[model samples]
Target: MTNSWSYSSTDNLWKPPATIIRSLINCVSKNGNLLINVCPDGNGIVPEQAVETMREVGAWMKKNGESIYGAGAADYPTPEWGRYTQKGETLYAHVTDQPIGNISLRGLRGRVREGRLVATNTDVLICEYWNPEVQTLDGPEDIFFNFARPTAWTYPLPDESATVVAFRLNDDEGTRTERQRLDEVRMRI
Candidate 1:
């Protein structure tokens, strides 16, 4: 995805998690390219907003590029957290919004081998859910917990604008879901 693409900050007023990063992430996840425009100022220098946005994107990508570099669509729905990108055995969850509590993956039961917060490389626990969701993040011991146990331990965000959750899928085949671009998503063309 190409960034620092066209944005009308004057009239359009680009919003954050910045449109460029958001577009690049979502497009790459669907196997599409994002062409970022570098709109220059009067002096032919990029504006502070654009520069800062690129820096933020670069910072996030440095750690999480593994998820987006060779990622494709997974057999999953558009998550509230943001988007899903699959690279080989790993599924990258790009969480744009700051989640309040543990966000449950509706059909993600036993699908993940394990998870890590891309920003901090911190481990996030996963579990299979039910009336009393079975959380297996800690270890096998936690799996045997009685009914009414927390599904899984939640991960703490490390002050990132957009954090990616890298999930190593149990199956190498990855998700069966086909690559379908989100209707709301648009490429820079």
Candidate 2:
């Protein structure tokens, strides 16, 4: 719990701008909530930086709050690009790190209804193509553009907190992709 005034004791613990947002995303991904602490002087007035930070957070919440409020941990393999939050039949993908190319939701081929970015202007390409999960003879797996006729997508990242890719989870897909996040969102590492 911290506020605008970076405590004199520990300055490394907190930072402004998207600190709250980043913390909120991280905590929410792990099924936790962020309790912020804001301190004021003798007067009841909140600090200016605190207020500004809140305004920014509020702006982000206005468009993407649906993915956070009343949401829970997504029952799927964590994506390297970002995190996941599920509410009811909707799976919200909170993309923090930017992706390179095609974003693939492996098991979700035909179970998807409609994808609404609802935040940024980036083009979201949801096509029926399966980018085969490659397995090289070396050691680590190379996950990249699987431009097949199955599952592959691409959504650019946002400037603020995260870029939410909301997918309507159908009843049929419930058993298959349970908590299984979208496969690969980027082509390159």
Candidate 3:
């Protein structure tokens, strides 16, 4: 079953409760998208509160939309605090909560060319590399050995209450054999 609800404020500033935002994050984490609506006044102007809320939501999207839009789920040895999406040689990572820092993905065996913060108009952040000395159970590995500090890229929510961040992975040199193998395993199930 599906459910829906609505909120309205004639005062032109309608802030959905924090509970609502938390719910949204949870939904997105579970592979769901949120469709928020802000009704404009009869004069066709969105309420100030509504605008602020939108800005905040936009910030979250700017930072984390990559994982929500089309990220894939993979099991890793370590707990990754973000979600990820991939298209061909491009992989997107969405970091909803956490201070910006180097991100590491162990047990990865794929060729990665470069890493970038997606919302920042394709700014290159990390140059990808592979370590022949390390290997996953499958075989040779190409893990994100080092992720430098995240670029200054960030989505400033309209409300200015929080921020969201995203990163992209480029593997155009045919280095996703590990991902392909994982796909094969899923198909069998």
Candidate 4:
């Protein structure tokens, strides 16, 4: 998704692997799809740079594909830090930029049960707050998520391009089955 189809001498304009990873998550969050074109050389061979980048992307997918594989667009607005993707009641926050203070997700409706960093598979602090001053017409109890850094991972996050935090939410009875499945998966991990 970064460069031209055929090879050009100046087409060394390949995007970094991390950028591609972020783009993939963003596309999934927006209910879209990504098609990365691996440009071949004049001799009909893929470039080494492109191959390396794809390998890096594959490595990332191995750890965090759950956030993108079957996710749909989030119902709430995107937060300042990044975009969001959802599967049933579960939400995945794709943090693309480093926040100044805390990562805040606004206008959420479901109750969050648990949150964890997809890369590290470790817990991330998820706090809900009720601010009367900033209350919206949506409801008196406007859901706001204060995603704090967990002790398990570094504060600023090691991944610069994107860091994913998966949140298991409780919204409806149908989601209970999914929640139980997530719980079972967590237990196995």
lDDT of 2 by residue, 1-189 (tens): 352453333333435656677778778878899877766546666656667888888898887888889988887767777777888888887777766555656445545655667575343455333333452212112222222223334433555467787877676644544224233223321
lDDT of 3 by residue, 1-189 (tens): 012133344243344544345445545555565566656656787667667766766666666565455644423332254444444445454443453333344434344444555455444333122221333333345334222332222322322232223333334535446567456423522
Q: What does candidate 4's lDDT look like per residue over 1-189, in tens digits?
A: 346776776766778998899888889988998998877777888888989999999988888889889898988777777888998878898888876543555644346667788888887654332222343234423333333432122257546767888888776624555456445433532
Among all candidates shown, the one with the greatest TM-score: 4
lDDT by residue for model 1 (70-171), tens = 788877878876888887778788877755445556566446566787767776644322122333233221211111124233435454456677877675
| Cα lDDT, all candidates | 0.58, 0.60, 0.43, 0.69
Best to worst by lDDT, what's the order?
A: 4, 2, 1, 3
Residue 25 lDDT (model 1): 82
Candidates 1 and 3: which is better by lDDT?
1
Q: For residue 167, what is the lDDT in candidate 3?
A: 36
Best by lDDT: 4
What's the CA RMSD for each of the models?
Answer: 11.8, 7.4, 10.1, 7.4
Q: Judged by TM-score relative to the true structure, which candidate is superior, 1 or 2?
A: 2
Evaluate model 1: give its lDDT.
0.58
lDDT of 3 at 46: 63
TM-score of each: 0.65, 0.66, 0.46, 0.74
**Candidate 2 TM-score, C-alpha based:** 0.66
